[model samples]
Target: MQFLPQAPTDRHTTLEDLQGIVTGVTMVALSVQFLQAAELITGQIAGLSLVASYPTGLSFGLVFFLLNLPFYVFAILQIGWRFTLRTFLAVALLSALVELMPRAFSLSGVHPGAAAVLAGISAGVGLLVLFRHGATLGGVGILALWLQDRTTLRAGQVQLGFDLVVFTLALFLLPLATVLWSLLGAVILNVIILTNHRRDRYIASS
Candidate 1:
């Protein structure tokens, strides 16, 4: 039996690997900064990380990593080893970036509305890179796309539904208006993913 290749692209060359790590780190950091600046929440593990960060004083990066651990097992069992490894490495890079961002940059008085827009765009772009690479940042997103393959539901809609639940929980922790901002962020984020992440649009003719 011939086994498939590990990844779509070669994983060698320091520059190529570094590119994925850098892209993942930068985008995840941007998303966290935007979320904190906006005082808003997102969906799935990232939202949970925001919620956990409130009490633990743990960085959102750390929280995000912890929350995604179990999901890696799910990914391995449901998807495959190669996907799981790529996702694990991507999440690790993102988590490290999140922890280091405070030292790298600061957000003093960012307005919620502005932060929402930036955060959405940053996250959308960041995840877009991972998806294009056949890797992921993990969490409900991984499951959403998996389900989309088996069911007739659109992946974006599935992700949106999950985001709703995550933001709904935000209502309890934040003011109603802040939760609204998060919802706006989610909408913008999803729109970017749907419009830009199409296989036909992203894939190059080899």
Candidate 2:
């Protein structure tokens, strides 16, 4: 009988990892600032949360935080408790930052097209940072991570599909021009993840 070598355990995140999470989330909050400034939307749960909060008196941060609640089970079960907890922390950090960003900063004359592009790029980089550190922002990502764990599928592909569905729903919630611009952002965002976040590419370090 041939014996297989055991897989090495991943090292726990360090203080630098936590700082990276903060920095990444701050960038995401900056992206959200642009999105709200233009009254535009992108794909993923963030878009859904924006749509849900549009007519209501509730805040975007609250809606976004609540929207992610359902994915914890998948995160914990498939990705492990550490990942789940880190994700929850990331989501909470994103939520707080989204709310705080508007108060701390504002932009004038930001075109919707520019907003979409900037928001997509900023959020993509932000998410990449989280992904590298073994975390996510919850929602479709949790599902993507779980699916990636169980199958040969790449998490980015799974995320792209979910992003498309959310963008389709954006049609009903936003203007045609806004949705079109958002589509561009979604494509950019998905492309970033698909190109950079492959399971085969992001090897674990000791």
Give the top-scoring candidate (TM-score).
2
> Ten residues in a row with the worst lDDT in model 1?
197-206
Residue 110 shift from truth in candidate 1, angstroms? 0.8
Task: In angstroms, give how far residue 171 of model 1 lies from its true place.
Answer: 1.4
Q: Which prediction has the highest lDDT against the true structure? A: 2
- For model 2, the superposed segments whose C-alpha errors exceed 4 Å read 1-13
lDDT of 2 by residue, 1-206 (tens): 97654443555458867977887788788888888888888778998888787778679899999989989987777768988888899999999988877777688799989999998899888888887777889998888867877888877789888878887877777788988988887778878887887655555431
As a whole number from 0 to 100, the lDDT of residue 90 in candidate 1 is: 87
Clashes of each: 0, 0
State the lDDT at 110 in candidate 2. 95
Candidate 1: tens digits of C-alpha lDDT, residues 20-122: 6568557867888878876677777888888788767887877788889888888888888977787888889888887778888889788888888888889
Alpha-carbon RMSD to native, per candidate? 5.7, 4.4
